[model samples]
Structures are given as structure tokens and as C-alpha cells.
Target: MRSTFDFSPLFRSSVGFDRMLNALEAANRMAPAENWPPYDIVKSGEDDYRIVMAVAGFSEKELTITHEQNMLIVTSEKADEDEKQYLHRGIPSQAFERRFELADYVKVTAAKLVDGLLTIDLKREIPEEMKPHRIEITDETAPRQGNMHQIEAEAAA
Candidate 1:
């Protein structure tokens, strides 16, 4: 049985969460995930992440990685099949495409194929102006004569 959820109430009360809600709906509507090419996502550091995909029969030349506006697209071009008839073929050489959604300020730094494994490294670099910073708080009650509160008190007198 397929399950569906309504997010109308959330939309009525929330702000700035449209993208997240759309992602959830899109994921629910997508087809069954393809498990042919196994992959792993690892969090290596506080702001660093790694994605490793197993592509046994694919070469570096046949694989492509693209970063387009918060989306990572990995595609494997279909190679010509040989005429050799195999009694039992197990390895997969079929063309496949995989996509990954990246958070804001997250970017792919490097990708390398080693020993039939494709590794992609990503890092999140928040802008200096956007990062959280310490804000100094001062005593409001005990203020200088030029302070707004003091001015207001004198004006009322």
C-alpha cells in the first residue's frame, strides 16, 4: 500500500521551508531506488563528507560527475558489449545515472577513481557574513545619558 501525507497545515504556518517540503514530496513520488551500483555516504569531519560508489566494470573515462546548482549528477556511459558469450555474467556494465542533493554552501572538492571505487569529497564552507557570531550584550537599565532609554526617561520628566 502506498502512503501519502498532506503538508497543507505546515505551509499555512511556516516560512522558508518550501524547499525541504518539496524534497520530501519528491522523494516519496520517486520510483523504487536502483540498488545495482552500491554506494556509501560517510561523514569524515565536522564539515566534510564523502561519497563512495562501487563501479567494478566501469572505467574512469566512462564515468562523469557534474555539479549543477545544488545537485550532483553522476553518470556512466554505456560501453559497447563484447561478443564473448559468458556462461554466467555477474558484473554490471550497464549505463546508470545517480543524483545527490547538496545543502547550501556545500561543494564538491574532488573526485577520484581507485580500485573500481569512485570517491567524491565534499566540504561545506559557510560564508563569513552568514556564519553565527557572538553578539555583545550590555546592561539596559544602567545606561548613559545619550542612550535611548535615558533620553526617553528625561523626555517624560
Candidate 2:
């Protein structure tokens, strides 16, 4: 049995969240999650993250990683070969594509394949203009002596 949710209320109240809500709804409607080519996301540092995927039987040449705006896509396709015959085939080598949504400023830094595991490193680089900074509050009621002198000099002139 499957359950459905009504987000009409959220849609009416929220603003500028259409993409996020659509992504969530699409995730809910997707087929039951597949276990093939399992992956894990880990937070390595304050602004660093790592996505490790088990890509057994896949080589570096067969895997591709791409970043388009806020979406990170990882795909792997193995070349078909009819020469190898296996009585028992348990490992999944079929073409698969996985997408990950990244937050603002999150960027892919590096990718490496080690021991049949593909590790993708990500770093969040917030621009200086976007970072939070303290704003100095000045007392407007009190006038500085320099300003008073300047005003007096201007009046005399």
C-alpha cells in the first residue's frame, strides 16, 4: 500500500519554494528505492561533505560526474561484452544514474575511485559578500565635535 499527501496548504502559504516542493513530491512518486550501487553521504567538516558510492565492477573510464547548477549527477555505464560467461551473476553492472541536489554554494571539489568505491568531495564556498557581518550601530542623537566645528566654520564663512 502507498500513501499520498496533500500539499495544497503549503503551496498556498509558502513563497519561492516551488522547486523544493516539486522535488519532494517527485521523490515520493518515484519507484520504491533501488538498493543497487549503494551510496552514503557524510559530513567531513563544517563546510565539507563527501559522497561515497559503491561502484563494483565499474572503472574510472566508465563513471561520469557532472554538476549542473544545483544538481549533481553521477552515472556509470559498462561496455557490453559477450565474451565473458558467468553461471552466477550477482553483481549489478547495468547503467545507472543518480542525482543529488546541492544547496547554494556547494560545489564538487574532487572525485576519486578507490577499492571499487567512488568518493566525491564537496565544499561550500560562501562568497564574502554573502557572508554575515556585524553592522555597527551609531548613536545619531549625539553629534561629534569635528562635525560641530565643521558646521561652525561653514556658518562663519
Candidate 3:
């Protein structure tokens, strides 16, 4: 059985989180999850991450990785198979597409296919202006030189 959730209450209290909420809702509505092409996501460093997927029968040419804004899309379409009789087919060669929603400033750094494993590296590069910085607190009673002109103008009035 499938389950559903309501986010109306969250929308009423939260601001600037529409994208995150929508992503969550879309995830919930997605078709029953498929286990094909098993994958793993690992945090290698404080701001670095890696996504490793098992693409047994796929080659570099058959796989594609794309980043659009905050969405990362990975797709694979196997080439036409040759007419060869197979006693048993265990590995699947069907085309598949996978998507991941990245947080702000998260970017794909590199991708490599080694020994049937596709490893994609990601790094979160926050702009210097957006980084948090400490602000020095000053006494309220202290005279401020920066606003002396404004104070003088008001006094003159």
C-alpha cells in the first residue's frame, strides 16, 4: 500500500523553503523505488561527497551526468545488444535515469568509471560573502564616529 502526506501546515509557517518542500513531495509521489543499479552516497570530507553506483554492463559512453541548477541527473542507456544466445541473463541492461536534489552551492566536481563502478564527486563551495562572520558588539553609550555627521545635522535642526 502507498502512503500520502499533507504539507499544508508547513507551508503556512515556513518561508523560503518551497523548493525543499516541493522536492520532498515529489519524492513521495514517485513510483515505487527501484533497486536497479545499486548506489551509495558517502561523505568524504566536511564539504565533499561522493556517489558511487554499480553500472555493471554500462560503459562510459552509455552513462551521462548532468547538473542543472540544484538538480543532478544521471542516466544510462545501453547500446543495442548483439544477437548472442545467452543461457541466463542476470545483469540488467535496461535504460535508467536517476535524479538527486543538491543543497545550495553544492556542485559536481568530477566523475569516473572504474571497474564497473561510477563514482561522482561533489563539493559544496559556499561563496565568501555568504559565509558566517562574527560581528563585533560595541557599547550603546559609546559615541559613534561613523554617524557623527548625521548626529551633527540633527543637532543643528
* Residue 117 in candidate 1, Cα distance off native in Å: 0.6
Tens digits of per-residue lDDT for model 3, 1-157: 8779998799999999999899889988988778878999999999999999999889999999999999899999889988999999898999999888899999999999999999999999999999999999998998897886553445565
Candidate 1 lDDT, tens digit per residue, 57-79?
88899999999988999999977
How accurate locally is residue 63 in candidate 3, as Cα lDDT from 0 to 100? 98
Candidates sorted on lDDT, descending? 3, 2, 1
List residue ranges in candidate 2 displaced over 4 A.
11-19, 138-140, 144-157
Off by over 4 Å in 1: 135-157
10 residues in a row with least lDDT, candidate 3:
148-157
| Backbone Cα, N, C clashes tallied per candidate | 0, 0, 0
lDDT of each: 0.90, 0.91, 0.92
TM-scores for every predicted model = 0.84, 0.81, 0.85
Best by TM-score: 3
TM-score of candidate 3 against the unseen true structure: 0.85
C-alpha root-mean-square deviation, each candidate:
5.5, 3.4, 5.0
